[model samples]
Target: MTNTPQPVPASQPIPDSTAAMKSAVKWGVMGLIALAVVGALLAGLFAGKEGVYGALIGAAVGGGFILFTALGVLLTAKLPALTAGAVLLGTWLLKMILAMVVLFVLSDMDFYNKTALVLVIIMSLVVVLGAETYGVLGTKTPYVDPTPSSNVDDDE
Candidate 1:
């Protein structure tokens, strides 16, 4: 008797988008915390308590923005594909405007070192973004076939 080849599974286990987003947020937060600690330490070493406070403030602001964006993405994940893009674009624009306003307000404050705050904010943003990118790219996912298969062979 001749043996027939077994059919391969239609799809392999793939990483879920929601799960990937969650992982990214978790890692991003951790990275932000680490960056904040480092920034605080550096500030304290160079400019004492004031600098440390500035660094902490900057880290807080940056972390807030990152978390806010992440939450928006998670919330929009359930939207229809066509609408999701437009909603995400709108969310991004709003976030940018809000962040700019907050930064402008913070810049006017005299209590903290502006230089330290600005530097930490920039650095923390980079860290969080990088972490999120890494998380998304690192996840394993399977490609789906768009076309359905028919039991009958095309060739007769």
Candidate 2:
């Protein structure tokens, strides 16, 4: 038997990112929540009630931003590429505005520890983003072939 090169065929539709996004969202959420618990505990230990409050708020804001982005992509997966892109962009802008408003409002409040809040928020972002990346990279996808349809007899 001789081995010959097979002619490549036309490309196919791009694979949907829903599965990957789902994986990302699921793991990212778990990681963020885990961080929230740990951060809250540590902060509470160090600074008391104010620390606890700060940790919770910070975790929500930092992790929530990225999680919402994943959700936006997952939700818009069925739409046309351009449409989905537009929707995601809009969602991102909205999230940014809301985050700014929330932070601005929180700035004046003296109920929470600012240092704890900032640290936990930054940590939450790093942990959740790492988890999301792991989920996406670890996902299993079916192989894609660009070869023409099979020419062998089915019943041979």
Candidate 3:
């Protein structure tokens, strides 16, 4: 119950905070791939080759769109907060524009099953985001207290 802070011995290594985030991203990507395969198989079973094509395209565009943000954050973890935020914000805007353009471009194309494409994209987006959220919330990461302790006996 005491607020007194205990010093960490140099012999004891600190836990890596980014490890949790990394694991989350890894699991998220794996989940997306798994979903893609399952979605493709089911779509193909119902809609034939067109379904498979639609599923693959949907997975690439939808899943990749969302996953790219997590990747940007991971890559910018070492950068200043403002810089990272700016980069992420910029990428997000660009991503949105590209996604819209892609969907619009494919709207009239009948090469793939539109239903299959739309369904897979929706499923992938939900499932991958859920997996990442679960991974992040389920794991624990340690952080340091930035404020200095009031202990007068502590060595400078």
Q: Of the candidates shown, which would achieve the greatest lDDT relative to the real structure?
A: 2
lDDT (C-alpha) at residue 73 in model 1: 81
Candidate 2 lDDT, tens digit per residue, 1-156? 544455544574444547788899999999999999999999999999999999999999999998989899889989999999999999999999989999999999999999889999899889999999998998765455545458845554
With a 3 Å backbone cut-off (N, CA, C), the pairs that clash in candidate 3 are none
lDDT of 3 by residue, 129-149 (tens): 988888788776656663564
Worst 10 residues of 1 by lDDT: 1-10
Go through the candidates in order and give each one's C-alpha lDDT: 0.81, 0.89, 0.85
Off by over 4 Å in 2: 1-17, 145-156
Ranking, TM-score, top scorer first: 3, 2, 1
**Which window of 10 residues has the lowest lDDT sum in candidate 2?**
1-10
**What is the Cα-based lDDT of residue 155 in candidate 2?**
57
Candidate 3 has its poorest 10 consecutive residues by lDDT at 146-155
Q: What's the residue-level lDDT of 145 in candidate 2? A: 53
lDDT of 1 by residue, 1-156 (tens): 443444456695445658778877888888889999999999989878889999998898887788778877878898998787888788788878988898888776787888889899999989999988887777665455434456746555
TM-score of 1: 0.76
Superposed model 1: Cα runs more than 4 Å off: 1-14, 145-156
